[model samples]
Target chain A: MKTEMAAIEIRNLTYKYQNAEAPVLQNLNLTIEKGEFALVSGPSGCGKTTLCRCLNGLIPHFYGGELEGEIFVDGLNVRETPPAKLASHVGLIFQNPENQLFSFNVERDVAFGLENLGVPPEEIRRRVDWSLELVGISDLKDRAPWELSGGQQQKAAIACVLAMQPSIIVFDEPTSFLDPLTARGIFDVIAKLRRKLDLTVVVVEHRLEALAAHASRLILMDHGKIILNGEPRKILAEAAERLSLKVGIPSVILLHRRLSKLGILEGLTPLTTSEMAAQLRGVLNRD
Target chain B: MIRLEDVGYVYPGGVEALRGVSLTIGERSSLAIMGRSGAGKTTLIKHLNGLLKPTSGRVTVDGVDTRKATVAKLSRKVGIVFQNPDHQLFAETVEDEVAFPLKNFGFPQDEIKARTEWVLELFNLTRYRKHSPLTLSGGEKKRVAMASIVSWKPKYLVLDEPTLGQDRENKLRLRELFEEFMEEGRTIIMVTHDVEFAAECGFDVALLVDGKVSALGSAREILSNVELLKKASLAAPQMAELFLELEGVEAQPVFTVEEAERLILSRLMSGSGRP
Candidate 1:
């Protein structure tokens, strides 16, 4: 029965920050099955960060907000659990890598979470090495936080979350500060890790092109409500029609949309450059 | 025009961020600096405003040597918007924030008020004029940071990663704003990792690799070169990649969706449409 439970379950969730005029998230309900990778995105101030806080027990516990609803993570009710305990089940990586990583070296930063959970020294050491190798940052284990580049620092941050061995991971625009190549590298690491570990991952990002290729589901939020949730391709095609949504449609899909309107590649939307390229070759080769 | 004569920069702790980089930026021109995270893009822009003096060479903005000029003086001609809005936004109200720079520049009270209102409307920040800048969202705060610097209307506007947190609407607005600036004969220098946005802006590009200018040219020439882009740890725009993947497509420099569409339509017309 426990194995059949969903990785995350939310029901009738409404939350408001302290001294706010109205609720930030209003009657939102979502369920993410085990091993499902969800990409949550919207304009800034769309309550994506607030939703992330609710998952790791930060809303009712740390933020001291009015949380009226239910959230279950790894079969544990988030509101009933303390953040310190929830840290073991759900890991939340912030947008800024500098905010979470404070230890002198990468190895120490990775070990901090396990140490706080009262894991023994040997276990911490083993977990740190395993997570560092998982992210391919083992060579920078001895380097200080400031000594690493932005991409390297973000990798270290992800390694810190991985060392906790959580069942679910939530990233809040982790690649917002990264460049195209570096951001792609971070996304590739995430995709590889999810495959290798079968981890349930939820990411909040505006750069849809980088993450859409790997996401099993796409969740679009607006004005604190889950406006659209479904397959990435269908949702993106729908989003393309509604200009008011202001979601950044990947360029390939935009090109696909343009070609489809011209009676070419109708009813087909490609997400990646390669996918669009293959389709373009078919159109070009046709005589 | 701004000129860098063999400029080099090294931080206090012995981090060699920039090496012998010599380039000349013509007046009324736009240049987008693209590179990896630690490739010294920020360090290179800082030299323009006298924030970081060159260690080995010289930087001159309109014939004024940066080393001899104070930041305050250089700022009058070069207004820089930092990457993180929180670093520069410390005002009680968005209106006051935009006016602060004008006041510092010794604009008359009437002119300051007019300019503040003008820029507030320009950024669509009039609705939040009375609100504290700290209370705004990340995107609004970035706009306020931009409004503050732009209020002064410096001859050279420097933006560090202007598209970091912006949405689609804001990016479109930015394109219009850059066009308006260019029409006024003002130069815009932006440091960014957004290759697509840079391509849309049609900016001249300088690719940095390990604090050295590895490649410099028009956006089409620099961004369309896959091998050169890889050297800077970057990739070509999606459209360019798409056309490149289609063998013998002959769309050598398509960077945006519109450009790609036009190219594809032409190709299809020549190919006599799909079967």
Candidate 2:
């Protein structure tokens, strides 16, 4: 059940909605270990969301589809287990916070998930406070979820899921609606949570520059399959063209590519701005 | 020609969203509004097109007081594309979605058809003209939303987070589209958190913080101001950050990636040994 074992294992997974003519995900096999920060990215309809749903037991439980293949989460078969049973081990935060938030105030919203599991009142109270503090929104506990800003509401939503103390957390474009500053703050909170709790993190995002520095492994999916998966720097360097085809590479990556083409940057492929600056410094100092 | 005079807005729940925010947007110029989630950027943008009436003070577009005009009336001068495409799109087909606004403005049938065709072509949505609005991808939905407002040809366009779901190539295309609009003498005010987009689009920049105008100047001035950007909870564009970290050599913050490359190449060509 720990991260040393596979947190999630998918084999030959293929799924198609009842109304769809073609499969959204096709013959996909992937393994997600515990305590790893994994980033999933692909084109809009490339089945990243569908794949995440399968991993968290939402495929057969929440959504009915022509599902083929086996999926396991935390040593349990997702097909056999309902989401209610898996909720304690895997937490899913959707793209839009409005869809997930139903409570009146921030505190009640964070406690709602734990309450559904029939947790003790005292334990629920403790987890709510701890989750709010983890997401850095304990101060807004009294405010209505609707009254909060888009970023604050997203934090509250994350806190709600965190209160359940899931071993693995999956985020589907959590920062898509947020402004840049708030997006950075949310990523910071994610980093803090991953380190403090040693939880497995998987996030699907289009904005790579923001997530690149923090992700331990970057998985690039295209047309319902994983095209690239490795250390962020290695996959980025090896699959630059495919990535560009899928979601379009970030500006920083393009710059690094251009520098490499001109023979200015050697060996090291910088991913973040700070890394790029350091590379430039090394180049200048060598001269 | 867009002007705000001591504009202050307090929501019905008594939360002060904007406080004494006053600024001017010139004709045919692009302005980028940067802010945190609660910095009141959306509130300020709503005033441009009369979506929200100021609780105190005044807002005028092209010398006409906004308080005296309705959204439909002001929309002729100001077209606003909201953040969520779902909130603005109601028509079944993409063509109908873009044409609805034109029909509401009472344009002739032929004119609506012509304008819809032109805007669809501009956004590369001509292929999906007959497609259902619900069936489009997220980036395509954003384009349709933009096309819906732009078909009206408002003199000034205000977009809220236009590039939220866009890929890099689409983002580049959007920059080109904004440039074309500027060339046509249409003013553009965009609310965005993508500092890199702000820099590449060649727009003057404004930082909104705590419901007030924290900093306003050319893109070079605002992007290079690390202290000001940090105070507003904004990250500088990668090029700007790189330039800030470089030692000895002096250069204005390069806004675009191409410009940054050019700056580095020029420095190397000149044989400037100073790091």
Candidate 3:
């Protein structure tokens, strides 16, 4: 169900926090189509988080910052709409899941957003059940949010967002605190969620190695602006220095960069280690 | 110099966060604690600095029983940098935040100032000395926390997820500081989920699972052990996993990009693994 309508569109957006000297996000313009999966990465303090706030209507509304330009979500003007009004169409999963979840139980936490939207009690119950099962946290429905592990708490937060039935979802480093195995599992769940729903996924993460292969588009930000935006491999291959942070670049891509510099390998960059190994097999297997 | 003897801890809520965990960290060594969340890594490290005493078993540093010693006395030998900076930060400025530890430890103003300034420079926070730590980004806050703890020069440094908010360059910088500490014969114990960080530092790894010491050994040998890592719900670093998948030229599960590149180049250049 690919649609031509842009799930998110920005026009010359610039924002600065109240006390901050310079704009955190400056003159950023972009468009993400419905159902598109985009991964955003950059060094710390590079405005990726600020851009996420802008996408979710938290920049000017909740952050109390000076914001300029325009932002549209699902063809609706974000500047004119309150965050409460935009919650139904755009769901933002923050960096710390524990901070976002405050309910007595996992079930109630997931249903909190639905209840806020005046969803009927019957529908709320059904959604809480459906989302908890989808996120694989149904068994922990009775447990308090504080009782779950970091990974499980993150899953619960995602369920809360999923229940809102937003067409666009923004995950702000959702798995930063998780181990590699659990982090990969969360991404797998997200991929499954994408297949099951018509959604635009924007993931802002430092662990790009785990999620690079799944991203259809990669956006690299620096100094409050997007420095590179394109296919994953191409961006990593061409403008790697700007994307120099190790956490965000895949190991395979790092190896590829080194190999290219030594003139040992060239032509295409691999986003995953397995993909790189596949590319190397041909070279290594040639007698 | 840091040792835990069959240490087991049960929180007030009746949750067994740690159990039967025994490990010894030698002086002048770097050890990485790897485990999934709630697998008892944090609980285990808290025992290092007397933040959380073991309900059973024992934890000792330098033959002194941690359970009997005061936290203030233990702070001189073992300083812990928590994952969340806000937990430890209270000063209005970053400079004062780093100084608070030294001053409370009864160091003279000159020593406190010197130590605070040195750590601020080391952590790249000198420019932000006057700024409130609360206003900094997550990465900067993490650095501030470290600077505050390391100012007193403890005998053992226990870091809880130091790389939580850091990128690759920042991690490398932090590794340099860790290396500097190692040179001074200080034991460094870090709890982290960053497998790449573990591999980069060449630390001896202690894997904690369900409050037990699941495995402890050279990170190289253990991180390459896929089955053991899988048992704890952990994955080998991407480089290690890739090396294992390759069908050529005696590849040991390499962990870092440099090691992987060396293996690939040796095979391809010598044409040894070629069909």
Candidate 4:
């Protein structure tokens, strides 16, 4: 039964930052199954970051907020557990990669978490090497964090979390500071990690087109509540519902819908350019 | 017009942020500066407003050397709204935040008040003028920042990643505002990752790679070059990529849905009957 439990479960979660007028998150209930990659997107000030903070025991414990919720990470109550203890179960990556990596070298930065947990020196070395290799930055192991490119820096940040071997990882707008092309590469790395590790991944992002195909689920948030959550393609396929809600449907998805409306396209909603091209070929009366 | 003449810049810690970057922006025109993070987009824009001096070359605005002028003097000709509004905002209220720039240019009290109020109303930030800037959302804070610098109505306006944190709706509103601004005969330059926004804006793009200008041309011409954009760590807009990926289709840089639809129609209805 314990093994069959969801990776994360939240019930009636309501939280307000200290000295703030209203709760940023309101009466939210969400359950992410094990090994699911969920991309959460919303306008700023919509509690996307606050929700991520809750999972790593930062909301009630670190931020000192008025929290009314039961958040269980792998069946352990996040509030009851200290952030330091819960950190092993759930890793958090902030928006700015610069602030997250501070060690002299990439290798040291990734191993910093393992060291704090009192892992054996030999085991720490092996895991640190493995994480660096996993992120494809093993060649940069000795380089300073500040010297790396933004995408590389972010990968180093992710490697830092991967070394801890957390079951659940939540990224708060990981590529907000990156260019679209580099952002696409980062998403590929994350999607690959999700598949290889069987890790439950949650990424809060606004760059939709690049990540939509890589994501299994999409959750739209507004006014601190879940407005829509379902399979990524299905949620994105509803142009009228999404537009009324003010979601930035990816241009590719919107193009597909527009073509479909004009009777130019039919069948499944395409989430990527290649998919849309395939649909175009089908419409040409070709196989 | 603004011109960068073989400009090169090196940060204090010896980081060569820009090297041999030569470019020009015509009067009352729009250009979108784009590249990977740390590719010196901010460093290049800073030179336009005299925020930074070129280490090895020259930058001129209307034939005036930037190195000969102070930032205060250059601000009258060029105004820059930096990335991250919170870093540039310090006033207790949005009103004060918007008023500071006018006061700096030494405008008369009444004129400052008039300009500030007008910009606040124009930017739809009049309601938030009394509220703390730190308390505002990302979109609201961005509006407040834009209202402040734009109050002076500088000849050239430079924005670094103006749409970075904004949602699509807010981005649409900002785009309309910028279009209006350009229509008033003021030059506007923006640094962004929003390829669709760049394409819609129909900007002359300056693509930077490794701190040097790699390519400069119209958005469609430069952005549609998949090999070129990839060298700079960029990907063309999804729709444009679709056109490029589909075999037998010509190299048409269709970015927006309308352009994509039109291209599809030409392919389908015009004797091809393709989807």
iRMSD, all candidates: 3.1, 2.6, 2.4, 3.2
lDDT (10s digit) by residue, model 1, range B80-198: 99876878988887898999989988999999999999888877688778877865655677789999998888999999888776778778888888999989999999998888899
lDDT of 4 by residue, A172-286 (tens): 8777667887677668878888888899999988777778888889998888999889999888876434553356777777777778888877878878878887878778665
Ranking of all candidate structures by their lDDT, best first:
1, 3, 4, 2
lDDT of 2 by residue, A16-41 (tens): 86555678788999988878999988
lDDT of 3 at A4: 48
- Model 4 lDDT tens row, B1-275: 89999999998767798989999899879899999877988888889988899998899998989988888889998999977676688998889998998898899999999998888887767766777886555556777888888899898999887776567776777777778778888899998888888988888999999889999999989888887888877888878788777753466667888888887777776657543
Pick the winner on TM-score between candidates 1 and 4.
1
The per-candidate TM-score of the B chain, in the order shown, comes to 0.95, 0.93, 0.95, 0.92
lDDT of 4: 0.83
User: Which clashing pairs does model 1 show?
Assistant: none
lDDT of 1 at A117: 88
Q: Which pairs clash inside model 4?
A: B268-B273, B268-B274
C-alpha lDDT score of every prediction, in listed order: 0.85, 0.82, 0.84, 0.83
Point out where model 1 deviates above 4 Å: A1-5, B92-96, B108-137, B248-251, B272-275
Per-candidate TM-score against the hidden true structure: 0.92, 0.90, 0.94, 0.90
**Top model number, TM-score:** 3
B151: Cα error in model 4, Å: 4.4
